[model samples]
Target: HAVVDTTGAGDLYAAGVLFGLSRGAAPDHAARLGSIAAAEVISHLGARPRMDLVAVAKSILG
Candidate 1:
């Protein structure tokens, strides 16, 4: 199947990694963050739709 709207996938992935690192998360964990963020963007219409991943991670970790 042909993919559509792959525009901001990279940006959202990078944002996840950066946000993870900002919160002192490990590399693998950060990568998971990237994966989750990328998945979210792909599921939705846009990339990085103002969702607070950091907060989400914090809730999960805590």
Candidate 2:
């Protein structure tokens, strides 16, 4: 993804990881979710999820 900025990627990544872990995912899965969140943020100009994060994670994780 094209990163317009890197300011909030870390926060988003952490959110993803935390969410995954909270959802009972393994470390690898949590990290993958974190990466997915970071990538999604980097793909656009903002730090927010343009799509629903749960849905995105489910789709990606699934």
Candidate 3:
């Protein structure tokens, strides 16, 4: 992804991993979600996501 910012990437990554674990995902799957979250955050101008993250994750993880 084209990184436009680095803010909140770590936080988003942690959040993703936690969310995945809470949803009963495996460790590697959780980490993959975390990475996807981090990548999404960094691909924009701010710490917030510009796209629908749940949909994005579903599209990717499903």
Pick by lDDT: which candidate is best? 3
Regions more than 4 Å wrong, model 1? 1-4, 50-52
lDDT of each: 0.73, 0.83, 0.84
Residue-level lDDT of model 3, residues 20-43, one tens digit each, is: 888778889888889988999998
lDDT of 2 by residue, 1-62 (tens): 46777767899999999998888888999999998888788777777877688997787667
lDDT of 1 by residue, 1-62 (tens): 23446668788789888878888888888888887777666766655455777677676545
Candidate 1, RMSD to the unseen true structure: 3.0
* Structure candidate 1, residue pairs in collision: none
Ordered list by lDDT, greatest first:
3, 2, 1
Listed in order, each prediction's TM-score against the native is: 0.72, 0.83, 0.85
- TM-score (C-alpha) between model 1 and the true structure: 0.72
lDDT: the better of candidates 1 and 3: 3
- Clash tally, candidates in order: 0, 0, 0
